[model samples]
Target: MQRSIVRLAIGAAVFTLFALHSAGQLRWRLLDRIETFTYDARMRLPAQAQSQAPIVIVDLDEKSLAAEGQWPWPRDLLADLVDRLFDDYNIRVLGLDMTFPEPDGQSPSRLLSRLSDSAVGRLPGFAAASAAVSAQIDHDRRFAEALSDRAVVMGFVFKQSVKSDEAPEQGVLGPPLFAVEDAVDYVAPHGFTGNLQGLQAPSGLGGFFENPLVDDDGVYRRVPLVQAYQGRVYPSLALSVTRAALGGAPVSLLFDPPAKRRSLNLEAVELGPLEIPVDEQVAAWVPYRGGYRSFPYVSATDVLRRSVEPGVLRDAIVLLGTTAPGLLDLRVTPVARAFPGVEIHANLIAGMLEGQIRKKPSYYLGLEVVELALIALLIGLLFPRLSPLAGAGLAAGVALAVVGGALLAWQLGAILPMGVPVVFTLFLFLAQQLFGYFVESRGKREISRLFGQYVPPQLVEEMAARPQVVSMEGDIRDMTVLFSDVRDFTSISERLDARSLSDMMNQFLTPQTRCIQQYRGTIDKYMGDAIMAFWGAPLPDESHALNAVRAALDMVAAVQALNPQFEARGWPAIRIGIGIGSGDMRVGNMGSEFRVAYTVMGDPVNLASRLEGLTKVYGVPIIISEITREALPSDWAMRELDCVRVKGKERPVTIFEPLGPKEELSSSVRESLARHRGALQAYRGARWNQAEAAWLELARREPERRLYGLYLDRVRQLRVTPPPVDWDGVFVFKTK
Candidate 1:
């Protein structure tokens, strides 16, 4: 009962911590980042419905720039382009994704005024001719005339701060949507860069293009639909364009009832029958249809020349912008890294028209709080009574449900807080499990103390969890056993003092032991300079032979690594050999009642010991029996050394030397291995001449390898002695 109480208490504490974070009483930057990351990922998913609203982008692209000269082209050209768009293409609404903060410097009137002030003004007819030309080519007036009474919304910018050297105000701002006092929540700009009075007066509609709610990570996932300037609320370019497109509908603010001691709570912005849900900051999530070029792009040059496909832009809402990098209108958006700023407005306008904008209302916070509370009840109150597996299942189910719910809400044009609830569920589950583990660890500790020395610490923990898997009585099972012994150990030990020899042996045995444990092999015993280990017992590993062979190879490498240190200490460089064999073996605690120890004993174990001794004869670091070779995967590289019957066994067994995994073998080594296989086949067939030739070639190419020389010697001797015709090719060992 006390244990359950402790578990529940831990769960409750963790729940409370995240619940506070969910309710905004506490802040966790990590959770906020996670939320933003998930939001981006969700946005990238295939949208349930693509925006089919008639929206088009009037892109001032590289082609347009090349054909029409550089950006900020003469106002007359813009005026002409505007006329073509309205007269030829019949665009419904046009919104500029650029700001015009100053009058055009290249206007014909300005040029003529400059000319008249020069010495040329003294010439006859100069003033009169200049006046007539100026009136005919006054580009700013012509551009303003093109915009008059049309559904054209000019773009502007909102500055967060005004520097002393910069103008505090520029051009002209359109009428405000509502006074700041009328709304409870808004993002107020310090200053703005509006369109020219001529342009603003002609259209009488302008919207700020600056995004005030770009995420802190510099990703434009959400943008405020409305902002405040000089105590008046203003709409963004997309909102303004949308309003104009809807027959210049009167936009109104929708507010929730004021809370105690709180002002009116802004919820949505309404224009005609369309309602756009917004968060507390009056921001709406960008409903990106896809990546770049989601909307049809009609190059400004093509539009100006009337070369666009007929009906492509007829009655279509167009956003005038540029994809040219030199124009500096690129933005980092959710769907694309270098997205055209104009497409953002197009997507927003389309979203507004189709009613596909996702809403994340202020009440989402309260909803998340409720979610956390339910999770707390499910985990804190119920997890303590369930088993660890059941608790884990519950936690996973809760996470899936939370994510599923969030996705469902998204599909329904809403966004529910997902990251915090999911994180809280995981934390509470882990806390409960950890508490349960500590409380139940006393029995595990006892199991460790009993068998810790014989098996790995991990195995002991497994045994503690499933005590029935391990037994004291001997049982016969198919397994793999490994034996490793240092070469010339007697001679090396004779040179070192007792203390020095002990330290050297300890240094040598530690890494070899670690190799065995890392490969999930159990140490059976350690004789003077030899180590015995086995796999496939206590915890049955199906890859017993493969793991044993891998451990043997690693043990040989470990000994080689220590040789340099030994030589530095004036000790002879050490060499070791390993042998592995697989077959049926008896494994369990064995000995007199007073001194019984966990170990394995059988024919395979004995054969492994003998193979270790034969490593000296073959001059190889590691060897394995035919059974062990058969168990390994084909990826392992092995060379058949010999077929021999030891003194006590009548049946001959094939022995092989491991050349490491095939992938690590050099090309030359692989070639040599192929030749060696042919040579072994010849020797086994009693083809003395062929065998001798193959062995001689191998010995010549690899003079340092003793195995080739040994085989070559055997072939020459057999040729000379001329064995009987009935003689089998098995070599017999008469001694251990």
Candidate 2:
């Protein structure tokens, strides 16, 4: 028991270590990928039902390229496209999905400037040539004019760690959205690539399209709502477009209730009336509805040519990007392998509008730790006491509860850790069950060692398989009980010396015990030459009654076979009477605590012993109660002897002598069984004349059978003094 407790302690310690590691109290790299994958699955769960958001995408797809030639279409064409979006289609806000880091070199104004700077520039007419050329074609200036005084946000990319010798900073940037006085400490990028000055000067704002928080597995599950670069925080494209749509309302960090003993952990970012929940990293989990094409996509050529349906982009927040394979904008995500990167931003914008962005704040980690401990503790204690099948059920129930809780939190726009707690619960349950098995096996071995010599080997092996079977608790089951005693053993014992008598009993008991054990019987105890045994215990036998009867027949045959050997040694040949009864009995380790044995006790067992005594009076080797005969198959041949109330019982039970198989009996034996049944029926019916005639004939044919003679004499006496009319036809036995 002390060793078992020690093993349980070790299991608990191992579970605690894993729980602490999962809670981030210990450093382990093996768990990082698992946690990340768990987060990915959580993000892909179905979001709360929401209306179709006012967000749309203007895709530069293959159709657009076929209609409008290759990309880098002249700057005037891009200017014209921008003009069409705001001036013609009347979009509320337009966000570009691509970047413009360098100026348009193919513009006519650039060509004219390059030609004028060459040797032709020294000519006097070159000034006239330059003025005429620059006046006609300045596409960059024209594109800049198109962006002014409009709700337009351009895209840029950031670098976390820069190694390039070239300048990492370019283009113009506006003031940070969160003021310096606000004192927000967010993650900052090392370098950035912004638009050319000409375009930057006219745009309303710029947003970084590149994600700085992609997970180690390269899946974009969370997008930063806001990021910091060079001590100033900037908004992402999704946030920039949303702010523009809301009429340029300023975005602020929310930390109404700060974390314990630390600076405030960012909880959410608020834009006017719209609040977007965010984690400590100022990122929101992407609420993916499905794969790509979640938002409505309009071809760029259709939009430019005004071929799109009217009012499609009227009040929609439009993102201009390409889906063509050549554009290289595809991304790997949880729901889809080849998800368009532009659709990611569109999803975020829509989520912000509907308040569907789920977040995992700093407090969730503490909740995760608490949940892990509770789940592990529950299954660890539960699994040791239950069967293997029940243990597996408990583990499955814990997993479902954990997963359901996580999903419920997601529905409420909160994130909680799921995988660690679930995995920990199952692992702890399995460990505890395995440890319990090891402990239980040792207990079974102890039982086998103690009971090996007392009971049949079959019973000992059964006890080894299930240690619970050997406990002191008693159980009620239908079982067969057997009792056997050598007839007149006292006379034989007086004739021999003590040593000779001991040798004779040993030789007599060994073969009989062997026959009993070989037929799956459990030896209960031995009283001198009398042996008590039973079946249907420790391991249940549905055919217990049949097996007990067969073992009794085998025991009688075995004793007969040993008679010659006994005579050769000058010892009297043994004759035994066996009694068997079947009924519900209590079987287990039963007795006072001072002295207990695994044995059976009940009325059926007492009756079996009583019937053993009757076998000597009736001159039959075997006597079985009616219940035992009923439990056997129909082919077993048995002759009903009498219905008699025993010494201690009010109810009268019919007893029978078991013969060999019905088909194996001789024709004369079969005719005798029929006539005996008829005579018993007539005797019970009080037809004294017919009963006397049947019994006389049976006695005359089989004069050696004493049972028929005993009944025949009773008929003659009962006829002289007739029984009362109300007699129930039950004979009473005064001796056991």
Report how far residue 143 has shifted in candidate 1, in Å: 0.9
lDDT of 2 by residue, 543-602 (tens): 998889989999999999999998999998889999998999998877786997889989
Q: Kindly report which residue stretches of model 2 are placed more than 4 angstroms away from their true locations once superposed.
A: 1-11, 25-31, 42-51, 132-136, 180-185, 258-264, 437-439, 445-736
Who wins the lDDT comparison? Answer: 1
Superposition TM-score, candidate 1 onto the true structure: 0.60
Candidate 1 per-residue lDDT over residues 486-576, each given as its tens digit: 9999999999999999989999899999999988888888999998899998778899999898888788889889989988888788889
Between which residue pairs do clashes occur in model 1? Answer: none
Cα-based lDDT at residue 485, candidate 1: 88
Which stretches of candidate 1 lie above 4 Å from their native place? 258-264, 443-736
